[model samples]
Target: MNYKKRVVKNNQMTNKTKNKFTTHNKNKKYEQE
Candidate 1:
């Protein structure tokens, strides 16, 4: 049960990072335009 909880937490962290990365890319795109 603890392992499952840890995995879920890690997934959430990765998702947050992914969101930040996508937003960063979008900002770069706007700058280029």
Candidate 2:
């Protein structure tokens, strides 16, 4: 049960980072245009 909880936490962290990364890329694109 502890392992499963840890995996879920990690997944959330990765998702948050992925969102930040995507927004950063979008801002870069707008700057280039």
Candidate 3:
């Protein structure tokens, strides 16, 4: 159970990072335009 909890936490962290990366890319494209 503890291991499963840890994996869930890691997944959440990665998801947050992915969202930030996508937003950053979008902003970069906007700036270029």
Candidate 4:
């Protein structure tokens, strides 16, 4: 049970990071233009 919770948490954290990274890249492109 605990292991499953940890796995889910890690997945959520990774997803958040991925989203933030994508947004950051978009912002960088706009700033360059």
TM-score for candidate 3: 0.96
TM-score winner, 2 or 4: 2
lDDT over C-alpha atoms for residue 10 of model 1: 100
In order of TM-score, best first, we have 1, 3, 2, 4
Deviation from native of the Cα of residue 6 in model 2, angstroms:
0.2
TM-score of each: 0.96, 0.95, 0.96, 0.82
Model 2: lowest-lDDT 10 consecutive positions: 1-10
Candidates in order have lDDT scores of: 1.00, 1.00, 1.00, 1.00
Candidate 4 lDDT score at position 6: 100
lDDT of 2 by residue, 1-33 (tens): 999999999999999999999999999999999
List, residue by residue over 1-33, the lDDT tens digit for candidate 1.
999999999999999999999999999999999
- Candidate 4, TM-score vs. the true structure? 0.82
Candidate 3 Cα lDDT to native: 1.00
Ten-residue region with minimum lDDT total, candidate 4: 1-10
Question: Which regions in candidate 4 have their CA more than 4 angstroms from the true location?
Answer: none
Give the range of the ten consecutive residues with the poorest summed lDDT in model 3.
1-10
Q: Give the Å shift of residue 4 in candidate 2.
A: 0.4
- Clash-forming residue pairs, model 4: none
RMSD list, candidates in order: 0.3, 0.3, 0.3, 0.7
